[model samples]
Target: MGEIKNRLRKDLTAAMKQRDDFAKSTIRMALAAIQYAEVAGDQARNLSEAEEIAIITKEQRSRTESAQTYADAGRPELAEKEAAEADFLTRYLPQPLSQDELVAIVDAQMAATEAELGAKPTMRQMGAVVKAVNEKVAGRADGKTVAGLVKARINS
Candidate 1:
């Protein structure tokens, strides 16, 4: 938004004036990503709130992955830096879905499928069950985790 961008610009300037390198760099990175989206034409027009949220989500995910890799390489200082940036980015993202919500979605999908199947179905049912639950919980949970949970639910 024009207002948010203006505020970010002011904050970035203040951070630079204060020699707050981390804050300045993180805000610059986020701004660059927003500009890149515009350049790529995906956001040719003014960005919607949802589009901004998606961009922030992407930045947060990248920061999280980078932090994990840094930690795994025994660079705790760098990892902590990445994590702090992630925390900043997270402020712009939607609240993450909880495990309970995810599980309930998965269960609902299974119940609906079982009702259709009338009883026990073949192993092939796994794919359909997973597909259905995944649609219901799309973008909220990790795909691999959902698949594993669906498999375990199907087996039990």
Candidate 2:
């Protein structure tokens, strides 16, 4: 019942009314995934906004990976379908950080870590830097990308 969840429901209804089969199906799948996440564990609970965003992010990632697998298997049609679904779900997530923004964040975190250590942070401290960067990035950038940047910055 969060904003994005409500938006997805409204969009699903709109898609159905417009006779847009693919959008309707994709949105339905997203909703089903969110609902499943809600009931996934010991007790039923409403998802906080962050939790809802995480579920949507997970669903989007699943579709993107599925699309890649289908493409690798040479199924262009199926790949396109999954890719479209992933793109649609992106609306519910925050915009990804641009590369320059990402670099600035990593650099800032590296500096902070360096200050804390009273010396330039070495690769050994990459984990701390990455953790700090991730906290600032707040899911906007992929973890691997952040780690790679942090490693490169440490090396340089």
Candidate 3:
């Protein structure tokens, strides 16, 4: 098993022993997602740390979206639960980039992209710019935020 999967299993056991319902359930759900990802292709295989992080990130995004939908439907209690689940899942993720850090990354990527393309990138090159920035950030920053920054920078 991967380091992350092992750590998650350990944490799940600890949570169960400590009678921490939220932690136990959240970890269980995450493990289930990981397991599903493991067998998701033509053949079963172990997941690398990056793949594990991607699964966890997808899970977090789903919880966040669920929370928003609940809130929009006038269900604050359900929304809070979903939001809390998202927060719990975030513990397994890398520390998120601050706005300043993200902007710095975007700036660096924009420079690289400009150099590669032999000019400042216009909106036409938004895809290339966003792809480069996303690779540099390596999941530390949110996609939408990165895309927004790329769009704004390209436009300016």
In TM-score terms, which candidate is top? 3
For residues 1-156, what per-residue lDDT tens digits would candidate 2 score against the true structure?
A: 678789989999899999999888988888898899889999988887777877888899999999999999999999999999899889889899999999998888887888899999997898888888887877688889999998888788
Which stretch of 10 consecutive residues in model 1 shows the poorest summed lDDT? 41-50
Give me the candidate number with maximum lDDT. Answer: 3
Query: Candidate 3's residue-wise lDDT over 1-156, tens digit each?
Result: 888799899999999999999999999999999999999989999999878988999999999999999999999999999999999999899898999999998999889888898999998889988988887777788899999999999888
TM-score of every candidate: 0.66, 0.89, 0.93
Query: For model 1, what is the C-alpha lDDT against the true structure?
Result: 0.78
Ranking by TM-score: 3, 2, 1
Q: For model 2, which pairs clash?
A: none
TM-score of 1: 0.66
Query: Order of all candidates by lDDT, from best down to worst?
Result: 3, 2, 1
Give the alpha carbon lDDT tens digit for every residue of 1-156 in model 1. Answer: 644455568889999999999889999998888777766854466666556656767788899999999999999999999999999876555566788888888888888888898976446898888777766654456667788878888788
Better of 1 and 2 by lDDT: 2
